[model samples]
Target: MINKKNQETLSHHLQKLEDISPKQLNKDQKDLIKKMLELLFNDPNTTTLEFENAYRVLIQRVKVGFTFDAAPSEAKNTISLLVKDEEKSFVNDPLKPHNQLIIGENYDALKNLLVIEGERESKVLTLFTM
Candidate 1:
């Protein structure tokens, strides 16, 4: 089961990982990650990432699950985003502005989905920084 603290850590990792370009993942690390993703995809009953070790696994799973937008015709013209910060105090926080990082493990599952959209730059990633 995914505990609370562990969940937060995962979010942090995902945020950090986003900054690192795919080219940086050396041959070995990339290969291992690829294998891990394959294993996870082959088995849907795999355990979801709830911590550091699981971070790599979770990324792999998300990437495989979503078909990133590479090239498109005139029809598919939508941009997507990967990471997002859904500030709970959207209408609240009268003192502070609306921009805030919603980095917490509890948001891992949702963030993963967003990242895929980001790769494609789909309409979903077009978040307004209010």
Candidate 2:
């Protein structure tokens, strides 16, 4: 059985997280982003590193507001955003391969992505299926 001290610590952390009531991102995205932050954040080893609100990515996506371009010159890469939370998150694991599907064949795959991406608190989603 878990010890009482550990339990209390866990409880307190849960309460703090609940009180904060942060929004959710897709689990995969959230995990990926946190790992990126853990490594690339100003300092990797320090716990509780300060950061700006919501995770951000440096790469630019090719979107004409609603639709993305037919091909990025770099082509066939996935962009993921990760966030942090207490529950079983994806931090510390190697990132799963993003589907680098080509540009024109993205619609059906986009729909499928939503099926897998549906579980988390992700209010936003993007699909770059080939």
Candidate 3:
């Protein structure tokens, strides 16, 4: 959650970030940029201390969630993938240990993967298509 004041500050910070080149940022600024990104992406595990530290130079206010109109739902064909209790490897290459094939509900899998990536601070480029 982000208070209105902090949200405005974050908007300003985003504009500032856009105005400056990545190379121009100092170490502290670079770290702040990362923290801002984490917050914007809704990193679920972000601690209160981390949030406070990130916004310390900005405004202090009780955080609140924003409200918006719900998006319209679409009707589409659905498919299911079956998985066994035991893990099975579809591909096994010692040279490509990081390569994996995830078979599950796409949305849930994507969310879980994003959480893992956030925790590890990993740079993972994912491409998805229907």
Candidate 4:
């Protein structure tokens, strides 16, 4: 079973992997791979073979029976501010605010936002997250 920390780590790795392209080398992907290697072997000076082996091991580990059980929900056309479990005491724009506070797992919230936004006729100009 995947713990919360492992789930968060895997989500981070998945995000990094999704940003990589086949046509060019990505610095983020390289850094992520190096970090993975460092975590696995406590050594960043990994050879190509070692990197490949580590990648294979990661693939095998990821092939488990894990699934995204969160269902997408509808949202209004407003600026979304995603936050974790912690409650924020202050608001920058309390008056004339068009912000929607989404509190939960960021990955799932993003997915749900995408789903909601996809159904709208108007296109979203920008998505800012912290």
Lowest lDDT block of 10, candidate 1: 74-83
Q: Which pairs clash in the backbone of model 2? A: 29-82, 30-82, 30-83, 33-82, 101-130, 102-130
Global lDDT of each candidate: 0.52, 0.41, 0.53, 0.55
Model 1 CA deviation exceeding 4 Å by range: 25-130
Q: Which ten residues in a row have the lowest lDDT in candidate 2?
A: 56-65
Native-to-model Cα distance after best TM-score fit, residue 46 in candidate 3, in Å: 4.6
Candidate numbers, best lDDT first, in rank order: 4, 3, 1, 2
Off by over 4 Å in 2: 1-24, 42-55, 58-130
Q: Is candidate 2 or candidate 4 better by lDDT?
A: 4
**TM-score per candidate:** 0.23, 0.19, 0.24, 0.24
RMSD of each: 23.2, 25.1, 21.8, 19.3
Per-residue lDDT tens digits of candidate 1, residues 14-126? 45555555655545554565455445434546554423356555456445554455664432444344444686323556788765666665454555566674656755355
Relative to the true structure, candidate 1 reaches a TM of 0.23
- Regarding lDDT, does 1 or 2 come out ahead? 1
- Among these predictions, the greatest lDDT belongs to 4
Q: Could you tell me which residue pairs clash in candidate 4?
A: none
Can you write out model 3's per-residue Cα lDDT over 12-127, one digit (the tens) per residue?
65665556544455456656665665564366565555655665433221123233466766434533333434556355677887856777758755655566667455443332
Candidate 4 regions exceeding 4 Å error are 1-16, 19-34, 38-45, 71-130
Kindly indicate the candidate among 2 and 3 with the higher lDDT: 3
- Please, what are the lDDT tens digits per residue for candidate 4 over residues 74-98? 5556555544445654556857667
